[model samples]
Target: MYRTSAMKQYQTVNIQAQTSGASPHRLIQMLMEGGLSRLAQARGAMERGQIALKGELIGKAIGIVGGLRDGLDLEKGGELATNLDGLYEYMVNRLMQANLKNDAAALDEVSDLLRTVKSGWDGISQ
Candidate 1:
């Protein structure tokens, strides 16, 4: 039998919390965990250059790690774009998809992106 949405959500969260560090594995783990707010935080990290994809700074991990690459690198927090307008927009879309469809895959995708961003901005404060 297929897992229920609540069950899926629980699984996703568990994965995120359990996984630490900036490994790509942890990023994917977080997506499955479920949390738009966390995702947004990650995005902010990426835009600021606190996270690296393929060893280079990436503003949008979504374009790169959709399904490819072994993993990503996460730095501490730092300043992102003066205006985080676009990043927020995409995050909302991802959050909706995860909530409405109960799509763990989609959540996983967005979560990775967020983690990359979060890693980049690990040290910086809002």
Candidate 2:
């Protein structure tokens, strides 16, 4: 219990630091990183047979994807935004499947997709 609290506090502080003075592109990158990190954790939890923790982590990943989707500026991003929304929806569905079935492959698939997107995003100079 003490360790969990300390970890949460550490994460909270880390997040606050990351967000402070961040540009829009940087914020999106952070969200992608956050989702990827959660998915990795969910995979580890699944390997450990920690069902509840796996679900929690998967849920957090889904929320991060949803946030990314929601943050898209359709007017500015145009077709790319639309495509990303579809991809995010697919990712969320796969995450739900992973949670329900303890399917590590599904998690891996989503993680790969997110990494690909993140890589592309990283290439853009902002």
Candidate 3:
């Protein structure tokens, strides 16, 4: 139980650091990271036959993607925001499929896509 407690503490601290005074870009990056982490967890759960855990993780991923889509500012963002909105939708659909079919490939695809988006977002420092 010591390890679990330590992990919980670490997560709490990490979340505090991520949210405290975070910019909008930083928040989006965090969301992408969260979704990627969930996708990874879901894939592992699928491999281990943990159907409920897999479903939960995939659901969390879908929610994160949806949040990212909804957070886009179409007016100020222009074409880029529109493209991202479409991409986020695709990611959510793929995540749903991954959850239903236990498809690791689908999970990997979404993970890769999120990583690419995060990489681009990370490059915008300020």
> What C-alpha root-mean-square deviation, in Å, does candidate 2 show against the real structure?
6.0
Best by TM-score: 2
Which candidate, 2 or 3, has the higher lDDT?
2
lDDT string for model 1 (61-92, tens) is: 23222222212222222233312334544654
Give the range of the ten consecutive residues with the poorest summed lDDT in model 2: 1-10
Number of clashing residue pairs, candidate 1: 16
Model 2, span 1-126: residue lDDT tens? 323432453355347657697767777787889889999999999999999999888877877787777677888999999899899889988988999988999999999999999999999999
Scored against the true structure, residue 60 in model 1 reaches a CA lDDT of: 27
The 0-to-1 C-alpha lDDT of every candidate, in the order given, reads 0.41, 0.83, 0.80
RMSD of each: 14.9, 6.0, 7.1
**lDDT assessment of candidate 2:** 0.83
**Which one wins on lDDT?**
2
lDDT of 1 at 64: 27
TM-score of 3: 0.84
Candidate 2's TM-score reads 0.85
Q: Specify the poorest-scoring 10-residue window by lDDT in model 3.
A: 1-10
**lDDT comparison, 1 vs 3, better candidate:** 3
* Candidate 1 runs further than 4 Å off: 1-83, 123-126
lDDT of prediction 3? 0.80
